[model samples]
Target: MFARWVQEILRSPLLRPGIRSGHRTSGIFVPVVRGSSAAGKIALLERGIILSSVAYLAFETYKWKKGQTVVHASIKVDDIIEQADYLYGSGETAKLYELLSQYKDSNDAELLWRLARAARDMALVSTTPQDEKKRLIYESFDSAKKALELNELCWAAHKWYSICLSNVGDYEGIKTKIGNAYIVKEHLERAKELNPKDATTIHIIGVWCYMFADLPWYQVKIASALFGTPPSATFEEALEYFLQAEEVDPNFYSKNLLFLGKTYLKLKNKSLALDWLTKAKDFPARTEEDIEAMVYVRYWYI
Candidate 1:
């Protein structure tokens, strides 16, 4: 209430003209009215001081209120993220995608990254035609790119950018796909550097290494013909990343466990492969990936 009153005084049109009329400057002066007494001048000075104090207090109060508003907004954003995460974790991919898509134009980096990831996962699990799947993947890439533009320090943005980039790579020609593969690795590495303890990022780096290592000879030949020998990796490299991911967050994602098991099998460690595969098989088949992991485990162990 007091703030509004002071603001009214500061913004009042009549107050400004009256104050300006009494002012004296270096190069110009306005003489006092003929019959104005010294006491009147003193009273005018006191009023000016009071007005100044009130204006200062009002400005400070406005700043405090603005700060409180920001804090509340931040809390609201956190709540939204928590709800989205629960939906995504519970395998409600379509709903999660729709929920986050409403915030496509949001400037918040965390929200943008989550939206990108939701889009990418939706594309992965979608049984739609190739064109629609590709469109969703591209949307994921664009959202991740926007998140990075908004905040370069957002590790999740880099992580999802790498994932969406790889998804888009599936449609590219061999040469272009190989180039995108390198870029995918670079982003994954950056994400790992920024968030070394992020199990998902670590698992993705392992997947990146595994995909390139497991590429068919024909694809490699095509890439080599188009570009001077493309980069190559080994199952050993993949195993290291997967192991690191497990160390950080053991069995967090069934897919991560499946990858660890598959990498171990590829590396000729049947015992370790069996151990990880069994864990993946027993992991509650909650999400699509978990169900897929169960199928793979049956195919391998049964």
Candidate 2:
């Protein structure tokens, strides 16, 4: 109730795509100090920040809980969706691709389903080994696209296809990956156009830029001279992209809080990160796969 009131008071109509109007991420809430008096307010703020800082931890909680749910899945396909989500959410590109490859012989009708799943997976992993993941990504994407072409479900493919392409940017070595960078970028841009209001698309773009802006821990010596100059909108742009995404798809990730919190830490901003992480910690949808994402987001600067 209070959160909604604050959102009503502060929401900017112009903010793109849309701001997530929720109570803020749980992991981020630790740093908050909400109270009646000045001291209480200060205390609240601090605690909220701490809570927010644990977005990664919160994400883990969600992942753990989610894994438990998947365990109870009644069927193979349901179990596959659960498993697929875990891999995709955690950013395990190589493993995700391998999973798709395993299902290569899926019967014709199931092909699109598996491909769509893989495309969604591609949107999460780093760009380095994308060459490694590409075959599966393409196969899956083509499968979905073909199905969509035959039917009218093509719209659904837009977001996942875009994601599959956009996420390849995070792989280890990208200078020589043929049909790699361009392929993903094309789909991503297309997604933005097809469904500019979608949260998944925004999240996809945000993750791509944030991960790239951070770069490898060891590459500073060689690329700092050029990449060091920093792209004016790279990180901030990603955040902008993601914020809009949240407005469109609040419940999409179940890990959105963790993503936002980690990105804030990258910017050396304290308050926002806390707000997000704290929210993540309290998620009822926790999954074990989310731990992978939490591990990546929870750490400082690395």
Candidate 3:
């Protein structure tokens, strides 16, 4: 029976490594950390014995009648955070809201916050060009503010609020909300200082830097000459950060080759720019239906 259990464990993929791949911990082992978990320890011991016996039975069943063998189901990405990757995009709200509304047994406030955010983004993208940007920013900011009303404490949603405020903060009275897009850097830094392991917070800091830093050296020099507050140009630095972000999660960004081509051109490397231009023409993120894409392809590339 013991040998059968070992054999069953050897045959089971779950017993080897999990979805994490490199850092896999077997679920069957229950570590005794301290004296606080009396019931837990007892339960662990009981489960260990039962599990081994079950494994033996499973192996025997596998040999005799495969239908009687027990198996553990694999966890899907959707199970952990429903449509989690879509959280980055503006189109995920309706589906998320429908799921949230149907989940009556849920007490998860974070889920509610995400649903609200998605709805707000939908409103932002659907508005007319004249009022769309500002209106969407306000709509999303208001949704995030409701997290507190929904009895939820969400620092992440608050961060999104700050992003929205920055995006549409060009008007006179509302300019104070985001004094400069650079303020987001400090906020994200604070979040990172508070939680060193928070990848999302770190990513946002990179984003803030990229947006503010890549505003064109000539334009910035001109602004500084006139406005007397020239922020140092860091396009190379911004590029580095964006590259890091892309490395962290390649699937998050829709193809953005056009920007890369333009960036290379801005740096005055026509050869590299032409190569990137060719690549950009094939990217799926070319939303603008202008000759700009092919023009670059022909002028510099051909």
Candidate 4:
């Protein structure tokens, strides 16, 4: 009886497998047996399970590949930054600039600020034409500005931006230089506030104080005309900043030593002036700035 029922079901028109255009039916084939209905349902469930597993595996594979790519990219960026820093610390400004200039359009605030610093240093030591020097300085300023825009809290960005701003003022005339004085001070203070341990930022703040303290009478008039309350500092204030910088990092910068000597001279302390000037002259000349410091010491002191 069971055999007869199976035969009848297989002979049914609904259960018959037919070829259309000499092609098999585009569907799962299930045998029409005693329990054809149940068998069909089971086959469908198995197909669904197989397809779900394949899709799950594919999705997991995609995620893993994406994660690995992101990690690799991060490591590459870190390596580049580390190499750039090494070049900079070694005082290879040209090499540092060459390495970092390739990434001038990078979105990384860290890279942009460092690139700006390299460009500024290059401009300082470059014997290029005046127009070429101006172009480089302006480029440095633009890079620093972009870095600040990308990250407001970046201490290095703020520091470089302020330095580049001051550099730009050199070509813009005395009025512009005096006009940017307060802006430069503001950014330097912000940079110091963000990272108090940065000896370079502290030293720049000291320079700011020194410049205002020794402002010429005509420039002072220009500053007065530009702002209602023009920035003012005394030789004593400049001395304090320079001393604080030295305390933070002893013998870190030759220029800082030179400024200390000059500030003491302004205050009429011949003994301290001579002492600091001697130190400045004796400081090692690793970079152009250090060489300039030695020359300044000799010209003004010895």
Candidate 5:
């Protein structure tokens, strides 16, 4: 049946259009005369069949090789997430977000927390419109929330949730932001307690303390009145956390040095402030925040 089909296609009128073989005078291949014998037409059909078979096989082989290449290069979910984490560490938030956003609906707690962190970081340095920033922050919060729902004991999930909430707090009203700030502290403390060696969490706690400490007296009074003794820290308290974080992981983040500098200035130690800020200025810029911190250090120094 297959052979008959091939014969039919080869002998089809479309392919059999007087395909003359050679120039009679020069004996070179050219269309000069039509076939005059039955045998000649049969030979032409046979040659067409052979050529068609070769062409079909060649096409099929090409497609098979292409398919094999795709199969070999395909990545597993774990491998993809691992690569995304590397991108995240390098401060490539856009690439990290692009790689992990496809897993937003995933139930895996680890993946969710990573996605949340990526979204939060992306929003922090985002140059987009206010609405887009809000969207990214909310998305970060949502992903972190989902991760905690799946496994509340996961320290990274809690940490990422707190970080996302902090970002969300910026757009919220003063009362709400103050309340969220306390929650952020709570989660950071929990994260630190869960993993004492985690320098990032310790650094975040230091940053949290520094932010509240630097708040103006009037806002402090308002927050105290509203929340009934809101969480507050002095530059001294902030410095301790920052130093502890440094002890655990030296120079883990450029912002840590920047914050240390700012905290010292707040404490009325100008010389120490200048020293720390100088170090921050010299630190290699890894992220947008790092570059911003460098600019801040120079501006304050001048």
Candidate 6:
């Protein structure tokens, strides 16, 4: 009777997927007498044990397959990152944003930071209403903050976080905006320390210096009142950072060229200013930023 019960269980449709022919099965065996009145109860208990064993094996197999799938997915992430980088290099900001936005909830710090950058870029170039533009900027800031939380050591996270934080200040009051300057400077410096060769990070530091150096008298007083010794830098300091960024990656960004020109103008060096402004004007207008750079050159320097 026990042998007949075992054969019936092995042929059951419910267990077919997990238990195939020639698959070894092992479990605790409870012996039973052939003519005993308790045979039915023993058989039921035996059946329960078999079902439990099959369920356990199925769960283990599922776990193994799930792990394999995770490994494959991680490899695909690298390919996606490469594709995103190519889009960015071509100044395809819209395409880059579309691709990375799908992974906004991803746990990867690298992808999150890149997404933040794309969102911020879109916000900068967006022709949408003010409320929509503000939404995008805040979204960018959230993504950057999330990336930083995931990996404090990620330099790109620090860089984007600083940029997004500064962008958010536009909607915030001037007092909050001015207060965030020191925080922005700290993150930019941290980013520079992590990756000194990044031209964009260096360029942004120069922008910070230029902004404070050119602050009007009333704003200067506000800053000084708010934070004792307010942040200050000279045109000479801003010029040095811009030049260093250029040295690291010449013509990498049109804004850098425009700023170099602006800094020279502040220093009363018209010859150098004109040289840099002309370069900015001639830069290919592949994206909105490049177009804006050209417009600035024409308006202020031409």
Instruction: Assess each prediction's global lDDT (C-alpha) against the native.
Output: 0.65, 0.46, 0.41, 0.66, 0.65, 0.68
In angstroms, give how far residue 3 of model 1 lies from its true place: 70
Better of 1 and 3 by TM-score: 1
Q: What's the TM-score of every candidate structure?
A: 0.70, 0.47, 0.47, 0.72, 0.71, 0.71
Top model number, lDDT: 6
Question: Residue 158 CA error for candidate 2 (Å)?
Answer: 3.6
Error of 3 at 225 (Å): 9.4
Compared to the true structure, candidate 4 yields what TM-score?
Answer: 0.72
TM-score of decoy 2: 0.47
lDDT of 4 by residue, 72-163 (tens): 22334555665555455445556667667767788999989988977876665434566766887898999999999999999989988888
Instruction: Indicate whether candidate 5 or candidate 6 has the larger lDDT.
Output: 6
Model 4: CA > 4 A from native: 1-75
Global fold similarity of model 5 (TM-score): 0.71
Candidate 2, 1-302: lDDT as tens digits: 54444334334355312221121211100111000222333454454445432332322332234333212222254444444444444434445444444444554334454555654444323332645456644555566555445544344455445443333333324331222434544555676776576555566666656655666545434344544433223667667766776677564454566768777877888889887776565443333323333433444322
Deviation of model 6 at 302, angstroms = 2.4
lDDT of model number 3:
0.41
Better of 1 and 6 by lDDT: 6
The deviation in Å at residue 289 for candidate 3 is 12
